[model samples]
Target: MEERLPGADRLPVGRRPSEGLRLPAPDRALSSRTGYTRGTWLAVADHLLDSLGPWFTPSGAQVRLPGRGSWSGADCDGLEGYARSFLLAAFRIAATEGDDRLVERYTRGLIAGAAGEWPRLTPCSQQMVEAAAIAVGLHESRAWLWDRLDGPDQQKVVDWLSGFVGSKTWDNNWRLFQVVGEQFLASVGAPYSQDDIDSGLDRIEDWYVGDGWYTDGDGQNFDHYIGWAMHLYPGLWTRMAGTAADERLTVYGDRLRRFLEDAVHLVGADGAPVHQGRSLCYRMAAAAPYWMGMLLDASPLTPGQTRRLCSGMLRHFVDHGVPDERGLLSLGWHHHFLPVTQSYSGPGSPYWASKGFLGLLLPAEHPVWTDREEALPIDEDDQVRAMPAPGFLLQGTRHDGIVRLLNHGSDHAAPGEGEPPADHHYDRLAYSSRTGPELTADRIDNHVALVGPDGTSQRGRIRRIAVDGRRAASWWKVGASRIEVASVVLGRVEVRCVLVDGPGGVTIRHGGYAIADQQRPEATTAGTWAQTVRTDRLTSVVVGLHGYDEAGVRLGLDTNAFGPHSATPYLVRREHPGGPVLLVSAVVLSGDTVWPEALAEAIEVEVDGLRCVIRMAGGPEEAEEVVMDGGGTPAAAGETS
Candidate 1:
């Protein structure tokens, strides 16, 4: 049954509730739908809040997740977590027209947190993160909670938050932490350093790479932080600034508007965002930009479309056990898969996903709730969008609703750096909405490696050459070897051709999707010609079109971080002596709705030295010719960078 927004259109925007006015209750039945309405989102928020009952202390200061992981190991982690999650609860209550029960519960905690009734956070820099969350929550609920606080209590809140005034923060997204807290302090007529706020905002401008994208910190670290933190705070800061908004506010709005165009495409038709980047634990936080855009009226999506995107993402996690049976979120992607966490992750980190509830602050009378839900970009049709700023080629297949990201840019390492530690998250050749980074020990899947003469493999830092339409090219070097690759994608099929000129006997290993061993993954091998692995729900296959020799395909148990087992279908070709050697192959991945078997009949390849012709099965019968340029003369073994 379709969810209808009852009486929401009749309500006025930003209607204030009288003393005893009751808010609309969330419909439980909506939770079961594959797609979501506003009520479904609220239901999830409420479910998250209720789960805290067992963990929440009587004073509302500490929420202890005894079984979960912790970072910082400070005594205040409990308090920090409670405050962060309470912020989400506060937004939901305020947005839902003041839910008395939830509001009272969260307001008590807010007052306690701001008043320092709980254990204080360690004086370390990491405290800035939790402080920012507290400030944002308080700012969002100002009318409902902050205004209700007595003068002394309000002063205490200021005094507590003042800890961030001159605190040192990391150069990356951490700058926004200070920016938001100080901005909130200024909004309340609290003493705040204009210089500090200006500095925080200024640094963000330096990180901007245009086309509405900002690398998280520096060195090609672009990830979801662009949405959750970078874009989110600026939009919220603008609202807090109001008519006092400066030129930067207009700039922020413009950037957000431009960003939504690409951000919306990052989400799969099934609601999963691109599973690339650190901190996969913050599941639905990806939806924050969608809500932030809607709140500022600065997004390209319609109000209905905004809700659809946010709701879809939230439902995606909820259905996948984001908040497990105990209603507690773990430090993992879907379930408690810990490999997805960064060093900074703690039990409460998942609460950051609460930022998605920023939409709850939007009144029901708003078009976002009243308008009929609209489909996302992928829901409409198959899409392939090239994001130059992040060096990502986003391809979404309408048939399976899976979005795949072909990475040529982001590596989390700085340029000019030789071979940095391989961060499986950013270093992977590709990321997908339906799959995760192969966080196993070797972390070799979805990457092309140059196996050294010493038997060790090295992956190079990628420099994006160009992104045109459905194709992208990149150049990178490992030791004395320089490699160039170009990718052309069609539906779930990607045709990648690599040219390498390295050491005398360097072999190239190109691995396809690291498909999880879900539902008893079985493999079918066609020797050196092609290889495939199929689970009941999905299929991953790689075929050698034009390569030197040899194919290496294997099922790797416990090789995936997301699932216990996975298999990587790969094609290995030994490099010919001295000159440039080219490896051409086709990789296909499809869900239950699409049969990858069709790609075998659809693909045709012809190779001529450095040039190759690729004709996708059902095309115009015309083959596209690709020329390869091998990096200058190969260096000897000891010629290191």
Candidate 2:
């Protein structure tokens, strides 16, 4: 017998029941790759909305779903439930050309909340954030909801949103929330500051680093916010403003088009987006920009490619058990792992993923829905591409179907901010679609540090020297000393060469990818090489090619988001007299079987002072040489034979 929600029977017919929710049958003819048609998206939207029935408060003022509250308290969390979900409901109702049920349900909440059941939006308050979603919802569904409301109710709603007229937001992507909220107000003939809207849109120009990348703020704070919030809101604001956004639309559209060119390669063949940055709990929100690109007709991807990419990402999360059995989006990746969430993440925060459903705004007959799915970049061949603006070297292997990002820049710290503790998400030397950094342990992965009496050095505020071809170079400081690193990638392997200019008697430690599983991973070490293999055969390997001694594995319990038990392979050089010493190693993460000895034997390294040459047999590159100049910065010396 299938367990059904109170309104499950009223859901559309042809609904294919899953564990706790019902979705439509796959349309394999149109979406052969992901089998997720427009009907599938509609079913998901309706299922999620229907699942929220029991959580609505009396008078429909707030939904107030279960789970812990954020720093903003219960009132704000309740508002989040109503506002965020309203965004999804709005997309659904608008795209369907009007769904009376959804409109009426959210309309009651809007009216009651405007009548004072909800908290007033204050300066920089969390309510201010929810106000943007509410404003956008009202604008998108104006005909069915806002226009149908009585005059007094409409003014009450405007009164609540007028809180943004003089309120300030954080300098980061929060600025765009004001732009979106105020623009919607202007569209509806309410009190709005054009200055707030224009300034908020103009402020992002300062953070744009070209090549379609923008740091979240003044710092090197590049992350998912660049897409989900930064690009998503401005594009949405343009839609609400219609022809009023003509000039800015041209600029924003070009920027988004260029951004999709790079972002398209970031997802793995299996549809997982690179897991780097904050707010990862928003899961599929990474797909928001791709949809926006389609909405604005600014995408480099074909309609087939856009649908494939977007549907692939949406399916990846669904396959991983997002919206758990109870059909709730928990504050974690894949499952309920809290460490991946931020302090600001309330239970309803995950609903921000409603941004991904923006595709629903397009009608079923749209090309993005009707087009046949196409292959992703990773699905066809291996790739090695460099994005200099963000200082990332993207490597994708067709065989393993995994994509790795070698991070040479984009540390979530301001320049000259001094050395702070390493952020597991943003400060790692590498991140991938298939692996996550060990977030709750002393032993970190994808990192190289000089360990001394003070502690292991952090890769604070990366100073990027170069990012070209398959190689990237950056340097960081440990007190008075400097550590420079250059990485050359070939297939699934990354050969990292490090030069340290510091005191003596310190231990240099380097860790490989962290592989996690429900059970303890099989760990092995032999003669300067180490590897950990999960039961499903995903492997993380590290080998010391030069300036290192012993190899080992570190076990971590409940320290990873992928699973409960995790293992990291590490190599160490003891009693190092750190001045001008160069260390070289090869690290790998793949789904293929990796023999440690064969990997170590395939790579040869030669070090002379601060200059190092690395050669890999049967690798993509023939040979590469890296040298450190007098300033202690690594530079690639081009390909060598």
Candidate 3:
């Protein structure tokens, strides 16, 4: 039976529900004054499940999502895809409180798949991820399915899931896959290696980089996976292990609490989560960490605030046509855009978004449902926070409620790989809650590139030096060229300075925001000083305040993962004269009116480059010299209220 504390209904709504947040209420039992209820989300989930009927194979072994291409990583796409989606469907169905015929049908399909009755459902090393999902799903619905199954069927399920016991998993987040699978095995009194469980848990701890962040692996692989998979698993593992692992549960609780503190700040006021990292296609899975925190009681957020963040994020995608007219989740950020997916991502991969519905596991009477919805940190005020582990300085704007991440850290490119190629997903100089990375392979946005003699620019892996308050610095290699850059950001303005030490005199191409432009853009240029391109929903403008020899609006061809085409207004300085070159540019992105008053600030630099001053909307004397390194603690300066 689920436990609940009375008087939860008396809890105040932390803040008025935002303007566009048409989210479902926490649950059904807790009567919402609005017509909205958790049933709305259930309907979406059911529709998603029903949409898969067209893709299921004869034996239900594989479910190819309605998409064109297949990933090369797996020999069989349908098997992994079907298993993963089924795991989600089964888990949700098991936790749901209602009489739904679809649930029974899905449960039967999962049983057949798990029992290996589907000859096409072959086991492989990559299947370890799916295997864990299946095991966890069975555990989550143990009373409804696992316990009801006959001895032979239960053995079949156990025998099939046992494939992960001694399997070879990837070194990174894949470690958690093994750990969760083993935890499930242990829960059922089945054969599981305690050594495997202990070692997997210990190894995952190595990925933890403090300040509520994990590297995903040894190199710079930080992304949503930290919240969706890395953190989500520990909570699930704790619940699966129960009292037997109380000591480890305490450790996980503390770590998860710390992580949520940072994670909550990443969401934008518009309900969009930070649009960095890979698997941009797993649209709503970004909410998994918050939901997991709720599940484990390890979060710092109030119950209402947790529901608000999770529900708001889900509604954000839903409002954007995530489930197309046919009710199918596509392989892209919002609608269908193929570039958003990695090679390992298959059609069924998006089903991982079901992890967002983890709150369904909580009983309806729980305070999370009874309490009033609260505002996110970004919603409450404009703020800036520096997360050292990820090498990011987070900036949240009060007017727009958009959270921008100044990334001095995180690149998908592995470390020590002689010369690693840059994946624009993680290498971008900045990412926001509203915009996406410019996906053009060569000419990337939100980046500083060293242009060769042939005009083709090269991007190198950037190693972070420090981030203090609104200031951040990093070093990157462009071919044989080595460049260091420092940025002092306030609102939309980022004053940047680049120091070059290389073999040849190179051109520095500082690209700004990659604003999505489906319609014709109203473009304006002011010689080499500034350029502004405005679409209906987005406006990208870049002003060269200093050191830029030329500035122009560059169009990226099918270069954005979020949208089809993007326009980047970049400032270029040629014939670098080889030494330290300072380029200060103001990049502004807004759906609202672009105010000149906010952009009028100027950056002043001294001869030695020792001190940089930001003259705010006020005057020169009000000019405050920003510490380039922020004295090593950037966020300590607190929000510029």
The number of the candidate with the highest TM-score is 2
Error of 2 at 191 (Å): 1.4
**On residues 203-322, what C-alpha lDDT tens digit does candidate 2 reach at each position?**
999998999898898867888888998799889999888998999999999999999999988898878999999889888889999999999999999999989988888877776666
Off by over 4 Å in 3: 1-36, 72-75, 97-100, 115-124, 595-611, 619-622, 626-641
Please provide, for model 3 over 1-641, each residue's C-alpha lDDT reduced to its tens digit, 9 standing for 90 to 100.
Answer: 22121112322223122222223443433332222245555656766777777777765666766565454343345666666666667656665643256446556666677666533223345567777777777778777766777787777777877777776677888888888888888888899888888888899887788877878877777789989888888788888888977998888888889999988888886568889988888878888888788888899999888877776787677656666656667788766778878877777777788777777787767777668777677766768787888888888877777788888888766655654665767777888887787666666478888777666564565567777766778776655556666766666556666656566577778877777645445555664544444454466667666667877776666666545566777778877776455556667666667643246344444423534555655433555564333223222121110
- Decide which is better by lDDT, 1 or 3: 1
Clashing pairs in 2: none
Give residue 120's error in model 1 in angstroms.
Answer: 5.6
TM-score of every model versus the real structure:
0.89, 0.95, 0.88
RMSD of each predicted structure: 6.6, 4.8, 7.3
- Candidate 1 residues 1-641, lDDT tens each? 33333232322233221212122343334323244566666766777888878887777767777544566664456765776797787788677556678667766776776676654433345667877887888787777777777888788778878877877788888888888888899999999888888898889988899999998876788889899899988787777777766688789889999999998888887788888988778888888898888777789998767877777787666545556657777778766666678877777778888887888888878888777677677877889999998999988888788889999888887645555676778888788987776665454567777765566454556666778788887777766667778888866788888887776677678887877744446666664444444544676777777773656555666545546666777777766465567788777777753333455556777778778788886654557777665543343233332
Please list the C-alpha lDDT of all candidates, in the order they appear. 0.73, 0.85, 0.69
